[model samples]
Target: MKKTKVKVKRLKKGSNIAVISPSNGLASVFPHIYEMGLKNLSEVFGFNMVEYPTSRMLSKDLYTNPKLRAEDIQRAFQDESIDGIICTIGGYESVRILEYLDMDIIMNHPKFIMGFSDATTFLSYFNKWGLVTFYGPSVMAGLAQMKNMDQSYEKHLKDMLLKNNKSYVYKPYKQYTNGYKDWSDPELVGQCEAFYDNENGFEFYLDDEPSEGELWGGCIEVLEFIKGTKYWPEPDFWYNKVLFFETSEEKPSPMAVGYMLRNYGIQGILNSIKGLLIARPKDYTEEEKEDLKKIVMDIMTLEFNVKDIPVVFNMDFGHTDPKLILPLGCVVRIKPKENCIELVESPYTNKNK
Candidate 1:
């Protein structure tokens, strides 16, 4: 696959961000939360956010409707004033919209795009096209936290997207949350799930040294769904990449994770990539995390016959609250000895450069 031109530029204060619903539009389901997110993007983050044609159109029908979602994305990029794009939130079926995407349009008018979970479908796609797409935060998912923001998340995101900082070292969340109260209840607005301390930091496995590469991969569930589709890339495409993986709220079992890793090994992808970075699974017990680690390691080493692949787990990103943004295709150094992930290059280029 030939790489497309990368036109991603750093976002500045007051950059117009098109809020599009490439997947589920929770904004339609919970209008108050959506409005709150819009307010924060404007007032707190100093961004000019614009809603596209179907940003608030919620339903399985529209989500499955590829042309509508694709048009929103195309329009967002075609609009000269829009500097970035954000998904309203993730859902079960973002892959459905891939066929309708005008890749020529996306390639010709590249811009920053942000979202994760099912949004991974687009994140990985754009990365393969050589455009930087973020794999963290969404309107309904990350913004609108009541009364407080995760200081680390806010700073890192601002530094990269708003300030154009090139260097960063990731630190584990001092506290993290996987708890979710029902969003259907109006009283739960701006409410946070219970949080517990994450004192141990990243769990380094295999070779706990350092590996540098552009980041790849996204939500495992979405990756599985898109496999063998036109959107899926070859093993050679993953060469010299630091692949990241996270489970969605669905939280498949440990055995299922083994199968996914095994499939990668079968495709000869495991040995080709430089490293692996796994997120703390949503709502998993400590025991389950350990189990997952063992399963993946066993398959990669014993079953797949690959060794010293450089793996890390329990990083602070994905479905969890207070998650960090990872711009796919950005250069990052995964240093297990330092217990951190470091950005080596700004994820953006100058507009005129």
Candidate 2:
């Protein structure tokens, strides 16, 4: 039998959250946006925020000190005062810090650690070793702009992090923004750009049957960084996994995204996974999205012949406004006919446990 995945206690009001910068030190550069996010965590979520040493370091300084970044994560888990951990923002080349992480410390004291984009490196790695990790908004990106978006965004974050729900059903946001406004401009610090209606919540391509699997995956571009590294999951890890993927703000072309999918097909991953959850590609035009959908279907159906697994597209996660918090290692059920995706297992252990 497979070893049981370890889960950490859920966060509550007044919980002390450790903020760290394992990726780029965007906190120092965009203090206005970062501070707004921290403010929301305090006033809105009722959490006490604790900043780590690397959370406000300069970008150049942080880039030169990947060891320091990894050390921050190590110390956060080791510190008894910290109830949970959240990232300042995502940045490129977080893979550099992976070498410095001590998994013994992280897995032993697994608590909530959430971030998306470049943070995928450590989040996915931690989950691979049986510790549940979160893939969601960071301080500068999603959290800062929470108040500007729909109120449901705040509720979703709280439900995932604070509440102990037996089963949670995910609903698509009525509207979403591709990205945020200029972070440097103090006037638009916490504001997002033009919003678009989410006409189709989730597009189901191969939903002939329902399936359940442990949720795994992150930004598709970030996953590419650890493809052949030890951080990459073993070949057997693909079995019964619902792999979720999305693009970054960099916005690779449809053909480019298809190339990445083709790689998974080549690895025989498409043949083993129970379901596939794809997020809306950031900043893609409507025409581009249709093209992406076609290419994805062609690759999975024609080339890989993966017919049984349920495939969904345009999910509300990754580099998008009002994102959902997806817990890696949690088991989720995908029902195609019902147009539903539900988290059947609680990702958190009781606080006293």
Candidate 3:
């Protein structure tokens, strides 16, 4: 039997959001970007930003004490006043904090929790426990750079986080940037690097027919860290799910990404999933993107003999600027004829009641 999903309350203008550094303590290292993100959450989103204990702790201290990081997450969930929780930034070793987390406290007091990249560890785990989690944006990454990106991004964030729309269609941004300019430069704070035209919003390699499934997945690299651990989902979890994945700024080569996807084929995940959504990689060239897609198709069709599933590439999420938030456990539909993706259900339990 499927577990009933624990829905969170809708966040409004005055809602209080707890900010934590569950991953790398980049907030302490780069206070400018972090502070700018908090400011945008306040001025733009109208959120009351509350900083947790680990939000600005030193990187060395945070790395040495995973328990402390987990405690901050627990305390935030325990706090009734906090309407939601967001990460300060993403780090590589946040998986270490998972063992120390109190699942009971988290599941019982389910509220809004959003992050990406390294956040995949807890977000994916929580969804497995039947709690909806968000895989989009962190403070220093997406949020801080918001003011400098397209207005569509700000609208997208507000729509996903604030509005309780029964159905929402994701529209690709008019433009995109690979990454931020420089966090350390006072003048360059909150500015992205170069901008590129989003000529092809969402390219579909396979769209035999429209399909719908619960949304799940995160940074592809981050998912690898928990593959064999207790936090990894069971073999049956992939069934009837739309798995979304994206690469980070590290820019794993096309061949490297192919190896990762090949593992999914081996695990029978490619056959089990309803559809596959690949976000535009952080800093890949046009040729590299084509190579990645070809490798993915080869793995699914030639290697695994699975070709019916809908495959979408270059989605506007993950490391790209002007992100569209994807809520895990929410049902989303892909309409081949319409060439569009739609969130078929409201992620929140309240539904703006």
lDDT of 1: 0.81
- Winner of 2 and 3 under lDDT: 2
For 1-353, candidate 2 gives per-residue lDDT tens digits of 24469998899899999999998988898899999999999999899999999989999999999999999999999999899999999999999999999989987787989999999999999888988999999999999999999989988998998888989999999999988888889999899999999999988877568899999999998999999888888888888999999999899999999999899999999999999999998989899999999999899899989888899999999998889999999999999998999999999886543
| Whole-model alpha-carbon lDDT for candidate 2 | 0.91
| Tens-digit lDDT track of model 3 for 238-280 | 8899999999889999999999999998999999998999999
**TM of each candidate vs. truth:** 0.95, 0.98, 0.98
Q: Kindly report which residue stretches of model 3 are placed more than 4 angstroms away from their true locations once superposed.
A: 351-353
* lDDT ranking of the models: 2, 3, 1
True-structure RMSD for candidate 3: 1.1
Question: Clashing residue pairs, candidate 1?
Answer: none
Candidate 2 — which residues are off by over 4 angstroms? 1-3, 351-353
Write down the TM-score for model 3: 0.98
lDDT of each: 0.81, 0.91, 0.91
All candidates: CA RMSD in angstroms? Answer: 1.7, 1.1, 1.1
Which candidate number would show the highest lDDT if scored against the true structure? 2
